[model samples]
Target: MTVQDIRSFNRFYTHLIGALDHGRHLYAPYTLTESRVLYELAHAPRTDVADLRTQLHLDAGYLTRILDKFERDGLVERGPSERDPRRRRIRLTPRGRETAELLDERARQAVGTLLAGVAPEDRPRLAEALRTVRALLSGGRVPRPEDVVLRAPAPGDLGWIVQRNAALYAAEYGWNAEYEALVARIVADYAQDHDPRRERVWIAELDGRPVGCVMCVRDTAPGAARLRLLLVEPDARGLGIGDRLVAAVVAFAREAGCREVVLWTNDVLAAARRIYRRHGFTPVAEKPHRSFGKDLVGQDWRLDLRAASE
Candidate 1:
C-alpha cells in the first residue's frame, strides 16, 4: 500500500475521534495526550516518571509539565518510591480518580456512539477486523478462540457468500466464472425456496470479519439435507472452522429429523474432505466430470445422522 493511503486513513481516523482538538475529548479540559497520561497514572501501580516517559514515549519536559499541572490541580500525588527513595512514584488523588472515572465513562460512550452506526449483522465482522488489525500490528500474536463467533447470516451475507466463494475459488483453484454462477444459483435457490426448519447458514467470524461460511439445505432425497458452499477463508484455515461448520450441519440435520446429510466436493479439496471425514461422512460415490472449467473427479459424501440418534 502507498504511504498516501496510510496517511489518508490516519487522517480519517483522527478526524473521526476529534483527536486534534484540545478539551474536545470528554469535554473535560484535558488534551488527549494529557488524558492518556492521567489514565496511565490512575491505573498503573508503582508508576515512576521514567516508566511513564518510556511507556508513553513522551518528552520528559512535557511529562514534567503535565504532572506539574496535575499537582497544582490536586489531582496527583508524588511519593518517594518504597524501594528507592531517589525514585519517585505517582498516584492519583481522590479528585484525580474521580476525573479518571469520568474520562473512562466518556470514552465508553464515545465508542458506543461510534459502533451504533454499524449494522447489527456487521458488528461481529467489524470486531474481528479490529482484532486482526491489532494482531497484525502486535507482531502476529494469535487471538484466543473465545474471541471468535459464528453467527447466522443476515441480509447481505448471502451475497457475500456467493462473491467470496467465487473470488476465493478462482484465485486459489483457477475456477472460472461458471463456478461463481453456480454458487449464485445455489444461494438464490436456497434463499428462495429452502425450508427454514431443515436448512441453515452459518458465518464464521474472527476479529469482526467473515472468515468462513457453510450452508445446510433441504436435499432432493426424501429425508436428507445437502451441505453446500462450505468455505473457510485461506487466512482463517487451520482454526477448525470447517469442522465446526460441518458439525453444525450434522447437528441441525439430526434436530430437523433428517436421516442423513450429504455433500459434494472435488478430490483437490483435501482439507474440506478431512473435515467431512472427521464428522463421520464417508465418500459414497465418485465420477470424473468436466465442470467449473476443469476436468475433475467429483465425489459425494454422506453422513448418517440416523445412526447417531439410534
Candidate 2:
C-alpha cells in the first residue's frame, strides 16, 4: 500500500473513532488521552510513572501534566515507588476505579452497537482483520503468553461456539448449513446434558474477548473423552492458542481418569491437526466422506494417556 493509502485509512479511522467515542471518550468527563491513561491503570492497578509513560508512548512533560490534573481532581494518587525509591508510582483512587469501570462498560456497549449493524456471519472476518491491522502496524509485537486466557464457558459462550464455528466454516471453507446444524446439535447436547466432572468447555480470550474455544465431553465409549470444536481466531493464530486449548483438554482428560482422548476432524484443518500431533494424537481411523458441501476425508485421532498408548 502507498503512503496516500495509509493516510486515507487514518483519516477514515479518525472519523470512525470520533463517532464511536462521542461524549468525550465514551461519555466521561476526561479527554481521550486522559481516558486512555485511566484505561491503562485500570488494567494494571499500580504502575511506575515512567513505565506508564513508556507504555503509552506519550511525551514525559505531557504525561506529567495529565497526572497532575488527575491528582488535583482526586482521581489518582502519586507516591514513592515501593519497588524503587527513586521512582514514582501511580494508583487510581476508589472513585477513579469506578470511573474506569464505567468507561469499560460504555466502551463495550458502544462497540456492541457498532457490531450490531454488521452481519453475524461477517463479524469474525472483521475482528480478524482489525487484529491484523493492529499487529502489523505495531511492528509485529508478539503477545505474551499471559495475554491469552482459558476459562470455563460463561453464559452465551456455548451459543458463540456454535455461531463462530458455523460462520467461520461457511465463510472460509464454503461449508453449508448442515455444518451449522451439526455444531448446534453438539453444543445443545453439551448444554443440556453435561457432567461437570467429566465434561468441560474452555473459551480462550484475548484482550477480554472470546477468540478461540474447545471442549472435552465424555464419549459414548467408556474410558475416553472426546475433544470437540477446537478453533483459534485467524489473527490470534501465532499465539499458540490452539495448542493451549488442546493442552487444557489433555490435562482435564487425564485428571478425569480417562484412559485416552479422541477427536474427529477433517483433513483440511491442517493447523489443528498439527497441534493434535504435537500432543501425541495419532490418526486411528480415516474414511472418505461427502459432507458439509464438500468431498472430504474425515479422520479420527486418539491420544492415549497411558504410556503405551502414546
Candidate 3:
C-alpha cells in the first residue's frame, strides 16, 4: 500500500477500536440513538423537538420514533411548552439522568485511557488539531461573535489571511496571482512601517484563533485616513466580524483626528459594500482595473467621520 493509504487505514482502525471499547462498557440496555437522546435532554432539559431536529439534523419521522422509544422506556418526558402549547419540550427523567451520567463517565474514561500515554504538554495542541479536522470535515465553517477580540496580527496570520483570500476569490470569481500579490504588498508595507498612533492593523480572533483582519492607514489628504485589507475568513463571514472590524477602524480614525475615511474594494464584495453604506459611506467613484489578468470594476467608497459623529 502507498504510505498515505497505510496512514489513513491506521487512523480509522484506531478510532474504530476505541469506539467499540467505549460502546462495550457504556451501552447499557439503551440503544445508541436512545443514549444520544438522553444525553441531549440531560444537557438541555427544556429542549424542544425542533431544536433537537436541527441539532441532530434528523427527519421528523425518525425523531418521532426515537422520542416514542424514549418515552416508552421511561427515559424522557415530553410535554407542551408553558409559553407555547403548540411546542413540545423534552426532559430527562431522574432515572435517565443517572444512566446518562454513567454513560458519559464511561466514555470519558475510555478516551482518557486511550490518550493516557500522550504527554500533558501536547494534549492541548492535539485536541485543537482534532477539532480543526472535525470542523473541516463537517463543513469548513467557524462561528463569529462580538466577544471575539480583534487584535494585532500574529506571526503567520497575515500569510494565512492572504492565502485564504486568494483561494476563496479564485474559487468564487476567477481571481488570480496579481490580486493575491496586491494584497500581500499592502500587508507587507503596513507591517514594515507600522505606526501605533496613525496606522494600525487588526485581526479578529474568536476563541483565540484569527478569523478576520483590517488595516487603517494615514491618508494623503490632510485629516483623512484609509481603511484597507479588510477580510473575514469564509467560515466566519456571516457572523458580523466585518462590521465589527469596520466600526473599529472608523472609531480609530476619529480618534486620530481624521475627518474622513476612504476605502477601495471590488463590486463583487457586495456584503462589504453594504457594511460600508450602513456606516454612512458613500460611493464616490468607480473605475475598471486590470489585475490578475482579469478586468475588474473597483469602487472607491468614502465615509465622512466628522459627519457621522455629528
Candidate 4:
C-alpha cells in the first residue's frame, strides 16, 4: 500500500530468490546480467547487438564489457547484419546456446524447488496473486476471458467460499455474520457428502486465482436442482465471471437430467439477478424477510431446464 511496503517486499523476494550480485546463482559462473544477455541471444539468434542493449536497458559501456567477455570466451561472434553489410549483429555460438539451455533448466529447477513447499491446491491461488501484482505494477489491462478458468472445488476452496462471501457481503451490503454462517453450512454440507454425479460446484479462476464460485445441489424435489452461492469478486465483476459461473450451473444441471433449477436470492443483488434472468431463470415468488441485519425482499427463481433444452 505504501512505497516502503513495496520496497520491503522487494527486498524479501530478491533475497528469497538468491538474487545476489555474485558469480554464484542458479546459473553459476555467469553473473545475472551476463546470463540474461546469453538468454536473449539464444532465443533471438542473430540479433542486433544495439537492439539487444536497448531491450535490456543496459548501459552502453556495461553491455560492451559483457559482450567483450563473451567473445573472449568464444561464446559469441559479432558480424555484419545478414541483409545489410554495414549494420552490426551478434550471435551466440554453439557453446553459448548450450550454456543458455543450462541456465534455463537450472532456473526452472530452482523455481520448482521453491514452489514444492506450497500446498498443491494453493498453488493456483499463489500464481493468481503474483500475476495480479505484476499486472497492476506494470499498468496492464484486466484479465481477458481466456484467462478465466472454471474448475472443480479443491481442498480449502470451500472455506474460501465462506470467507470471501461473508467478507464481501458485509463490506458491500452491511450484512452480518449470519450470512457467513449460512455460507459455512452450505459448504460444510457439500463437504460432508454429496452426489458428485448429480451435484456439482465450480470455482471461477482469473489468472489461476479463485475469483468467483457457484454450486448446484439436489433440491428436496426429486428432479430439481438448486443453484446456490453464486459469487464474483468485486474487482472481477465486469469481466463476465459471474455470467460464466451461472452458465456452468445451468449446463451441469441440464446434464444431470434435472427437470428444473431453482435458486433463492434477495432482490438487492441486482447484478446477480440479471445474470440469472439472462440464463432463463424467472422470478417465481417473492416475500419480505428479515435476515442478515437487513429487511430484504427474498425471491425464488426457477428455470425449467426441460423447456430450455427444447
Residue-level lDDT of model 4, residues 1-310, one tens digit each, is 9999999998998887874323366767888899888977754555677877886889989999999999999999999875576777987776776787788778767777788889999988888799888778757766765456666666679999999999999999999999999999999998899997688788887765689999999999989999999999988878778887787777667756889999999999999999998889999999999999999999999999989877
Looking at candidate 1, the ten consecutive residues that score lowest on lDDT are: 19-28
Task: List where candidate 3 sits over 4 angstroms from the true fold.
Answer: 1-144
Instruction: Sort every candidate by TM-score, greatest first.
Output: 4, 1, 2, 3
Q: What is the lDDT of residue 43 in candidate 3?
A: 46
lDDT of 1 by residue, 51-161 (tens): 778768899999999999999999888988655789888877768867876886688678777878889899899877877667776687675443445666756899999
Name the lDDT of candidate 1.
0.81
Q: Which is the winner by TM-score between candidate 1 and candidate 3?
A: 1
TM-score of each: 0.58, 0.56, 0.55, 0.59
The TM-score measured for candidate 3 stands at 0.55
TM-score of 1: 0.58
- How does model 4 fare in lDDT? 0.83
Q: What tens-digit string does per-residue lDDT give for candidate 3 at 218-246?
A: 88888889998787877677777888788
Off by over 4 Å in 4: 1-139
Check candidate 2 and list the clashing pairs. none
